[model samples]
Target chain A: MPFTMTAAALKIDHLGKRFGATAAVDDLSLEIAPGEIFGLLGPNGAGKSTTINMITGVTRPQTGSVSVFGYDNRRQALIARRLVGVMHQEIVIDHFFTVRQAIRIHVGYYGLPDDPGWRATLIERLGLGPHLAKPLRELSGGMKRRFMIAKAMIHKPRLLILDEPTAGVDIELRRSLWEFVREINGQGTTVLLTTHYLEEAEKMCGRIAIMNRGRLVALEGKETLLNRLGGRRLIVTLAQPLATLPAALAEDRSLLSWDPDHLTFAVAGPGAVGERLRRLALGGLHIADLDMRKPDLEEVFLQLTGNGNHHPAAEP
Target chain B: MTGPLPLPPFQPWLPFLTLLKREVLRFLRVSFQTLLAPVITASLYLFVFGATLGQRISVLEGFSYAQFVIPGLILMGIINNSFANTSTSLFMSRYLGNIVDLLVAPITAPQLILAYTLAAMLRGMLVGAVITLIALGFAPLPWVYPGLGLVMALLSSFLFAQFGLIAAIHANTFDALSMFTNFLLLPLIYFGGVFYPVSILPPFWEGLSRCNPLFYLIDGFRFALLGSGDNPFWLSFGISAAMAGGLFLWAALLIATGYRLRN
Candidate 1:
């Protein structure tokens, strides 16, 4: 593991940004270790992109600071920029150049000497060899995404920020992209990813941060986050219709949903699950069948934001 | 996609040089629209304005109207194309959202401005050269002070390219860019005394014409090219140079502050 006690690859402290009267990001703080694959998760307007922009020096923070590898973004902007690479969510390519030209140009922008063998290797590794001659505007979405990843990696920065990299990609391809990211992570590059796909975050990010309404709602190791904040779910298929609940159990009806032949509710944790079952049994109900669900990242996200819109992830 | 030529050793100037190369290549890629269009347009102007009007007006005592007007036409070519080069390049980059290339790069504000301005100068000078060549076909023109004429051409083009940069930074859409071009840029060119000398205007119009910056550019270029009047070429040079310097500073300030750019 490349994780260490050295300065963080990225550190954002008390960062804030406001547009007009609305706070896009509010006093957010985070420290991503040198070799960790960290995920920043949020609903559409949860300020995830604004945080990324601040980190990349595209948007200046009004309150605090962002540093890449100990170099402050604003004070040592050129040096910080040279040490980090970002692939924004928007797919913007210069139509004037081809993929080959576009990728090679990054070398000059960062003032790095070009290595043809490495360039060819990146092109081949990203499956961009065949499309190198095509104009950038002519490529399909998948190829463009791949090309953008290549562009981001051209300078070989120590840290890479990918904002929604697998967005709009098919399931199989999305998995492969994550596999490539894993390969890069294994090679000792720290990765910061923002993703709408909960399963993707669950599988890839060792740690995750969830944001809501311009605030950090949760930030923890994946398992820890799930255990602490992702409450368990239970569904009961009744032997008889849920009718005439006991007075004590009826008082908890706000958290319980009961239809003619089904009953559902959330269990706060392991202890709460048994207690809830005891209450249901005390109500003189026979349990025909029961289903218990393990909470995924989506459950945690929905619980935090109280919004289910993040799941579709395919939102255009 | 023609494979980029082999890379050289690393240097701090590489990014600036790379941007310059890309910008020069961008205009060259569309040679017909950027380079050839101005030449054909200048030729027609010379024939109609120079030939037909030469028989009627004599601004300078010893020269035909063709000789007197050629310098103005050449300077106009330089100004229009120089402005077009920077304005279209920056506006299109912003419009298409590819400006992220510069925003995220290690290039600084001064480097960005220099690269854009230098590319615009190349384009403006290229158009001026072709127009001057065509003017030679109209008559045998004297190259009185070719060096000074070149200096004036460069200074005027540099000034207008800064305007283009400013307009591009502030323009939100192509329509807004066109408004700058149509409303501000073209009017300055038309009233800048391209066909006839500003001396022919009434006292009030001539005073207004003198207030116009383009008038000094044409006046200086004409004085250097044909020695058409007693106006000192150095005076025109000083004014154009000062204005160019001022606009360059303004552009650098805008980039440094991230006005309408980083946001």
Candidate 2:
């Protein structure tokens, strides 16, 4: 995809934060195009939360600025905040509030008029109607998370930031949350997501930014990032087991591993599969089955993050 | 693929009102701890003092001991409950990490201060009204200048609410919060002439009591109801108005600076 410097939904310019002598986010700059699911991936303590804090105005940045929908977050915080909604990493609902009351109060804060229809739709969609009258303390963990989403969506903000939204939830709930997020994004809301689940990010995010030690390590389209790693593994099943590797395959033995009738070769690129298969054919190897696997976000993430150095088997 | 979102009409008052409603409901939902408990404690104070000391001493002219103590008790409830309403609510929100709702909202620092102070004042007023009604059983409940009485009650509540927000912002632990109430607030209440008039104290102690803002609040409130107090009505009123305005501005500045509440 061609990169253009059009208007952005969210923009961060040379943002930096520090606690005493240690820098949390150092000179970070990025712009998220409107209506895209942008993924922010980082290891623990890599300044993802600090950047979110600066964007949300929970913590003022020592350097640079954040603008949401053309409004400088610090100078025009009220206007900037109105355009943004955030589902916090923790379930931070007030224990004394009923589900309905909590959503109403949140809506009121954005100066949005009370809309019963929209409220009902949100409750029904999040499956929180039955818990409307129950205090937050009475709800289950997943229910509280759903209620948090309901609160965040009360004003139908143009930008939604989800920080680890599905962490610790069951698979079913996680999928449901993803669907709800996608549904809202489909309605023209820009989404910024941070998650530990690379599979989720790979499946959902259009573009991904990886951070390490308060710096941007990689940022690109998901496919571009994955392809840039140039990692592919080919597994071939031979018709007969071989005690010794054939001469043609022996030269490629470093890339090839054998287990019974199956041989796995670590190919450098997707195009190498054709060349390797042609080589095997010439070597008089009877191939019963063949499978080619392109690198996924996990492999790329591990590589860019240098996790591959310490733990080579970081990705399954 | 997406068009611009229609911006909502900026009804600024709605956010303030909603925040006030949330703060009020927070305490009303836990009436046992926020309301009934304070009223019960006030009643116990009234019973212990009015029953034992009422029969022996008459502190002021043309008034029984119970009548003289009633206004002080009502004001005490106002100060304590008002401060507790804001301090406890804000501290609890911070402790539980739920204050992000308010911090991230489209409300300014002054607006936030107003919402918290007003809600706290409302709780304080409600508690004060209940205690006054309960005190009627002990005394006739004088009402000389009803308008002035209302003004005094509001100013006192507003002042204490601001103080409470300041305390909540500075306090990091439960023990720290209690220190504000026990060491600072309770001493001010006791020394402010809740049980005895400052006029009866020695010259040095009376001058020292004048320094306590709560003394002015109680003295003014008593003068409004009974037409008599240690200081002139204007002095008390001036002191309260100054404290309320000054403390409110200070708290608003602190809030705007994101002191303690935000990183």
Candidate 3:
């Protein structure tokens, strides 16, 4: 986060876009550090894809600017574009080409040469080697996703933006895909990702930005946000079923759940749990087993978005 | 694949060249529909109108009707295929959502237009060449003003290819695209003096035919191939060149600005 004199790898400055009176991305500004894995999380219609589209020059920003490395995405568009590679949300497979031919041809789209060694490395790395001579459209869904990854990395881009890379994929592909993403980040390629799976973001991202209805709701380091927004929960199981006479404990607003068997409260610090326990004993409540639960990314995401039946991307 | 390779030298035109190659390969992959279909259609016209009908009527001086219609058939093939290639290529890319490949490319607008147009022209000319060979079997035709013939072919192909680019940009559905070919394009080709001499028509129809744009292309090509046409070579060539130049500017503007191609 200390991107002082060194330029940010991807800098979005008050970027805004509107579609027919709807603000798809409203006055959003965020910076990504070089060699960092950044996560953008939101619910459906939260403008994640619009933001990526602006960054990749697929859509122009209405109010603000985007820059990749040191080049403005609009003014120095060709240069800025060369530095960023994108794997679109959709598969977008071309039926006219073989997998090898499409990957080799796509390299030139970024004005890069066809380095056979680098090309082979990418094909093998993405597990696309055996399907090289097959038509691109003939590949199965998982294989097509792998082919897309190879295409996105064919130019050896400095920054890679993946819009929902693991959506609808099986568990094995998702695990290998995340591992490959981490491997690429380790090799100095800055990555910006938006995914539906919150647990994946928790494990992969160093910094996370949460958006809601086209605005930034939270931006912090992974652990900091987890602690600040996803505070710990303390659950206490009662020795006996209580019949509705816990006014003193119920009045505390941090208390989340109470049942015949248990009482739960949201606790910010370790001290809060012990203090609550002493108060419970003083109130003549029988002693019971106590359990502590650490909040995961899913809790924070649910609280921020208020709904999660779908995902957050391609709203614009 | 064990060790990373050093980056290769950058070629500025690599993207343009690759796109051009892709566009050409697209039609060639379906050679039956693109090349053989047009050739077969042209030969049918030759056989029906010229071989069977030629024994009765002669349209031009010292040249049989078969020889006269040959040039027109070739020009029509060049025009239709040129338009078909680019329009289908661009529209299919949009329909399948793969146009994002071109949208994200580092190449410029002119490079994009030239690549598509040139590839379309190659297909158009290939179809024209096959039709020409088929025409040769029907009649002994003189290759009059061969250099002029090539120039006229290039200009006609360039004009139609650009028009196809514009059509693709504006077409929202396959129905809209088919309307262009059925209602507008075929009628113009039919009225443009493809099957018969414009001179044989009534004065009013002949005068109206002069106003049709395809008339100039066919007339100019006829002058080049058979040394006889309704209009002189310079007049037809000049009009075709001017139209191509104007269309180029329009196509270049639309492509550079991503008019209907991007949001």
Candidate 4:
């Protein structure tokens, strides 16, 4: 059982779905490890939701299969669903039900008796205790999102899929939500998240799969993705305004650009930044201050999924 | 870190019970619309049809117009409320995007159909009972065979609830949902011996009335209530029972196929 849990919290093999002439998801395959926070990043119409839908059995796959905790989604849907919990992108809860009542209904869905202690802990953690008696319609967007998270966690599912969990949340609330997610992950729930907020994925996910046009463009650790850009930027603040570029600096025009007050250079390696600084100094260019900018996941995302000739995982 | 928590033994019926409770509560929460309003509507029909028309007409040989219309109105209440309960709930769930609550659960399609259908039946029966009480105020409703009356009522509720479920699945908008209730259901109810006996109709019209399933349900209900109907009690009972079973299977099939409920 332990081995089964570790092998794949979720496994999608050659999954495909089509609506009319359009393919919503095409030959999508992924495996999420137990106890890992996996980020599924994509732009609009990128099939992240489609894949999530198939995993939760909300939508059937036209081809292939999804297995959750060793239960095939189609053949053993009930068991597969038992192992997974999903917080949908929409705030789709019953408006007539109060927060507590809604959560109770969700708890009952998993066949669990209401545990007041656990319910209280979750409510307090989500900062929803004050509004437990408020109807869902009365709650704010962020509060509703918190309620959704709380509902998803009620079942103690082995796999929790959060689709755009922080979409409409404020910055402070997003922080709190992230902390809450980490807390749950710490308690052994494997989180599969999708978000438009790249920074959220960078900070929270151990691994991420970037999809575009119903295909995965990149799947790797956050650090590995960032490192693929292969270099960093050097921003140099000049001591005095430069009317014109020095001949020595002008020689390497491909790597450097300068305005009246600052010079920017794309350095190839860690040692190259220092080498360029020495070169600029030797050329009698004065530097007031210098800062190195590390490449981030956002850059890699734009490059791989952006309008470019480089197609990291383009379909044949 | 400690290992993952072990989940308790999942009792499958718990979800069915929860969904059933939620569906029932959905209507009860708005009792004014789901229960009281229907009773009020049925009362107005009783007033307009029985009070106004009773003095001028007598459709049955032994019964007064009020007695004849009472069973028909009660059965009409059952059919309307049952269909309304399931159709509106399912459609609203889809419209508001809340259907995912059921879709994501570890419940089967059969359980889903049963829960929604049972809840619809309850709402229908509640309204029917209220309307029957109102009808009783006007005239005594004899239960010639209480068992058959109860069975007929249950079967009629079941069949129409399944109809509502099908309509909800097929309807993409509120307009489409109302179209079924208005265009199809209202027409059938009106022509199904709700207002008059099928035996009195022209030969061509009588045969056409037989095609309407509501005719059998209303006739079966009338036979149970007054021991008088245009068709044999056995025929009416058999038709309603067969329809109930067939509609139930169709509902189960649509749910299992994921129909419009899923992608």
Using all chains and alpha carbons, the TM-scores for the candidates as numbered come to 0.90, 0.90, 0.92, 0.92
Can you list the residue pairs that collide in candidate 1? Answer: none
The residue ranges of model 3 lying beyond 4 angstroms of the native Cα positions read A1-6, A236-250, A257-264, A275-290, A306-316, B1-9
Instruction: Give the alpha carbon lDDT tens digit for every residue of A82-102 in model 1.
Output: 878888899988888889888
What TM-score number comes out for model 3? Answer: 0.92
Task: Evaluate residue B110 in candidate 3 and report its C-alpha lDDT on the 0 to 100 scale.
Answer: 84
Off by over 4 Å in 2: A1-6, A235-265, A269-290, A310-316, B1-6
Evaluated at residue A51, the lDDT of candidate 4 is 91
Clashing pairs in 2: none
Looking at model 3, give its docking quality level: acceptable
lDDT of 4 by residue, B180-223 (tens): 99999999999999889999999999999999989999999999
Instruction: Supply candidate 1's per-residue lDDT for A220.
Output: 95
CAPRI level of candidate 1: acceptable
The candidate that wins on DockQ is 4
Give the alpha carbon lDDT tens digit for every residue of A152-264 in model 3.
Answer: 88888878989888887778878888888888788888899999988989999999999998999899999987775435677889999888857777566666667888887
Model 4 CA deviation exceeding 4 Å by range: A1-5, A238-264, A278-286, A307-316, B1-7
Encode model 4's per-residue lDDT on A73-188: one tens digit a residue.
Answer: 88878877888889999788797788988999998888877778888888888899899889899999899999998989888788999999999888887888899889878877
lDDT tens string, model 2, B1-263?
33333455778888888998899899999999999998999898888767777656789888888888988988888888999999999999999999899889998887888889888898889889999888888778579987998899999899999999999999999999999999999999999988889889999999999888889889999999988888899999998999999998888888989899789
- Candidate 1 has an lDDT of 0.83
